[model samples]
Target chain A: MKEIYLDNNATTKVDEAVFEEMRPYFCELYGNPSSMHFFGGQVQGKVTEARGRVATLLGASPEEIVFTACGTESDNAAIRSALEVFPERRHVITSRVEHPAVLTQCRNLTQRGYRVTEIGVDGTGRLDMEELQAAVDDDTAIVSLMWANNETGVIFPVEEAAALAKSKGALFHSDAVQAVGKLPINMADSRIDMLSLSGHKLHAPKGIGVLYLRKGTPFRPFLVGGHQERSRRAGTENAAAIIALGKACELAGQHMDAENTTVKALRDRLQDALMRIIPHARINGGGAERLPNTTSIAFEFVEGEAILMLLSELGICASSGSACTSGSLEPSHVLRAMGVPFTCAHGSIRFSLSRYTTEAEIETVIREMPPIITRLRQMSPFGREFLKEQS
Target chain B: MWDYTPIVKDHFLNPRNVGDIPDADAVGEVGSLACGDALKLYLKLDESKDKIVDAKFQTFGCASAIASSSALTEMVKGKNLDEALAISNQDIADFLGGLPEEKMHCSVMGQEALEVAIAKYRGHEAPVHSHDHDHGPAYPDQEGTVVCKCFGITDVFLKKVIETNRLTTPEQVTHFTKAGGGCGGCIPKIKELIDEVMGARPEEPRKRPEKLSNMKKMQLIQEVLERDVRPLLWADGGDLELIDIDGSKVQVAFRKACAGCASSGNTARMVEIKLRDLVAEDIVVEEVPA
Candidate 1:
């Protein structure tokens, strides 16, 4: 059966070009980038080239890009470094809809004498700018927020939020893991003090991430071991994945226009078709500016896992914010923060598309999802009640 | 994703006796939208109302919750009312092989709804006790000192689970009862309840230092509040205030978001424990009604 993978925000399939770019490093170019021999020296030059390519994608200088294990590590390094630099500042501001990478780190900070102000979102999953404004006090060490929410696909005004943080004398960091390739980001023009992006989200392999520190930001190393990444993130570099990321970044730059055009249109086609076919299904972040190739649709009175299970049998893949779907006791925090009704929250499904996402796959989803929802709704008690109410 | 047993997946996919019985003799419902799961069970009873002749359920929850409800309806169909009441959450889970540790509440919901249906049939009504077995004759006025705020688990319930299951440790309590699973703010309280139940050490005169200096006393109170109470309150967008201490009576206040919460008294008592553990035994925390 043909497979349809629509959960790109969770992680994407690595591009074949990027994979081929990384193949040699695991075998022939196995020498360390820090080594003195010719084989190793050549690898070091390629690694530096990779850094330049990644930097180019983010509109940053190569010197400012610090490579870490993954996006979580980058987020950790940024938040921890901000705190280490400004020990006297105990307040940290972040939106309530951040991915666990930033949210969990901010939560951990609260236990260590840091006060966190999680700015709530509006009904459409848009951040309340005024609330975020009031949260960024002078005592705030940093304001960390996501560029785009992973669950809702809602885009945050990171530039405006970063500027607001800067005005309050607080460092600003954006976990741009989901937004890096799907959305246009020029760290050079923005007030973002630090920005994080993962390789995996941009069709690169996992195990590599970049923390772009706008030059002259307060510096502290979370992993203080080797002189790698200019001692900013200390460890032996993930040579292969870093090379893959470089290649992926280049491909992402080429596909960036396609993301807003073909990919966006494909997503829209799939969304509109699904919504048209399935009555009472609404988009979670449809009212706000969202990622071009992503849509989170909620089919009321139905559980997401059941829909996903039925979809899986038909070679369609997606994910849900439902408590049962996430293996958690509550629905997605993004949905809860947006005050999504319990009926919709329990059935929220995020369909994230990437360059690899084909119209055929989307068509497959459009064809397969309605029946799944109908089947699950037939089984759902709320669905029955809804039908009763309709009648 | 939860590694649900095949039986559970089977029950979830092809649930038995689904839909409502509108003209049913009795109905039992439990859980809510806010709690992320709910179940409505309808039972058709024999003329004697002593035997459950047929059963059906309508559930809004995850796969396991739906499956658990479906499994429950199937399990209790042929049994008498009393035998059905004897069926526990574990039985519902056991019927479906087993549920994930986190998904056990779904099973608990099934059992509570069954009890409620039985109660409805018997001409006595009570608020849904799906959260735990703390309601009814189990505790006077269906009231128990709530220890785990995340799952609405009461101290009475914890003690009962421990006594019945011979459980030790908060982790075991979470596994068997799901008390301190979410947020984990109630874990220290869960530990204390376990300690209280096991008779490991008396609440008073077990861990307090013999004599603490005035400097040490002040430092301890501040540290405990800062280290423990403040973070917990702050997590929920609330702030705590230490106003005045007169002898052993510590006057505390909740500020910002948590000011007028009904649970402020319970929160104050939690603060009182911190004060008692750190400084002295007879430290009473009176919330200054702010």
Candidate 2:
């Protein structure tokens, strides 16, 4: 079976070019970038070039990018550094829809006597700016929010949010793990003090991430030991993955136009066809500005895991916000925080496309999805009643 | 990702019976859209109304849930009401080779629907339809106080699952019945219920061996503490570390929530009782301040 991989937000395939760029680092060019020898000096030059590429993608200086293990580490470093930098400030603010990388860390801060406020989102998964504005006060050390929601694909007004945090003299951070490659981001033009991005979310291999700290932001190290990463992060450089990520970011910059146009058209066509063919369904973040490559559809009267399993049979990969899929007894916090009703919350499926997603793949999903919904609905008691009423 | 057995996949992909019997002799429904899974089981009995001649199901849930429902309908087709009533959740899981531990609640839902169907047919109680969505008990006809408000599960329902499955921890209860899986506010209550159910079981007295090396006795005590006692404490966010053992007396120190608790004495006594029953009749548990 030819796999139609659409779960890109979860992770993306490593581009072949990016893989080839990193291949030599493992064998022939395997030298510690920090070693004193000339062999190492040559590796260091490539690493510097990679850093420049990544910096160009984000409109940041090479000095601002500190590579870490993954997005979670970058997020932890960003928020914990802000808290350490402003120890007297005892409050943190975030949104209910933030990825767990930020949300869980902010929540854990509460146990250490820090007040954490999670601003809610509206029905369309749009961040409640008013709630955020009220939550940001003099005592707030930092306000960490996501640039885009992973499940709903809803884009937040993060630059405006950073401005709100700045007015209160609070440091601002954004977990741009989902938005960095999908959307255009220029740190030089923004008030976001710290931003985190994962390599794997942008078609690089895993195990590499970047924390962009604005040049003049007061900061502290989350991991402190070696002089690696200018002592901001203390670990041996993940040179190969870093080089791969740099190449991926450069490619992402080149593909940004097609990502916004071609990929967006594919996402829109898939969303529109599913909505038209399948009754009793709604797009989760339809009213909000969303990432061009993502769509979350909620099919009523059926569970998401069941839909996903049937889709899996056809080698069509996707993801869900359903409780059962995640091994939890409650629907996703993202949907719940958005005030999505229980009826649809338990049945939301997320389809995230990438540059690799072909037009035929989208068409195949459109053809196979409705019958799967129809089959599951026919087997559902609530769906049966609804079908009866419709007939 | 679930490690679903091949049989489970077979059943999920090609479910045995997947519709309704409009003239069903009894209709049993459990769970709701809010709960993330639901099953509407319909049974058609023979002319004598003793044996189930036909069984069909309509389910709204994940793969394991649909497979369990389909397995239940197939298993109950030729069985009489009493025979069907004898089927446990484990029996349903075993029919499908086995379901993942986290997916056990799907099997429990199947068993509950079967019991509800038979109970309704026998006029034991009124049928509670899930479509009402009142957030009331999933099995309102079965009597008990509502313990897990999130899933509308009652103490009666919980105790039955715990006792039948021999479940010791709150996590198992959640996996089996979805109680204490949401918000987790009722977790302490669930721990208490587990204690009550496990305590109600009859303990058989074991004849103590006449002679044992001191090392062996100490090892036995530690094994019992690790296997039997710590889980119960861990469920309540508390734990005990064995400090030392001198002959029959075991010195222990409470940790976490158990430390400095006013009820530490009662907890110590309970530990002593457990050690006495499981190891030796004269074992003593002494709590030392942490």
Candidate whose lDDT is highest = 2
Tell me which residue pairs clash in candidate 2: none
DockQ numbers for every candidate?
Answer: 0.31, 0.64
- What TM-score against the true fold does each predicted structure earn? 0.81, 0.87
Per-residue lDDT tens digits for candidate 2, residues B202-247, read: 3765545566688888888898787678767765646789999998
Give me the runs in candidate 2 sitting further than 4 Å from their true place. B126-136, B200-290
After superposition, the stretches of candidate 1 with alpha carbons farther than 4 Å from their true spots are B127-290
lDDT of each: 0.81, 0.90
DockQ of structure 1: 0.31
Question: Can you tell me the CAPRI class of model 2?
Answer: medium
True contacts kept of each: 0.53, 0.87
- What CA root-mean-square deviation does each model show from the true structure? 14.9, 10.9
DockQ of 2: 0.64
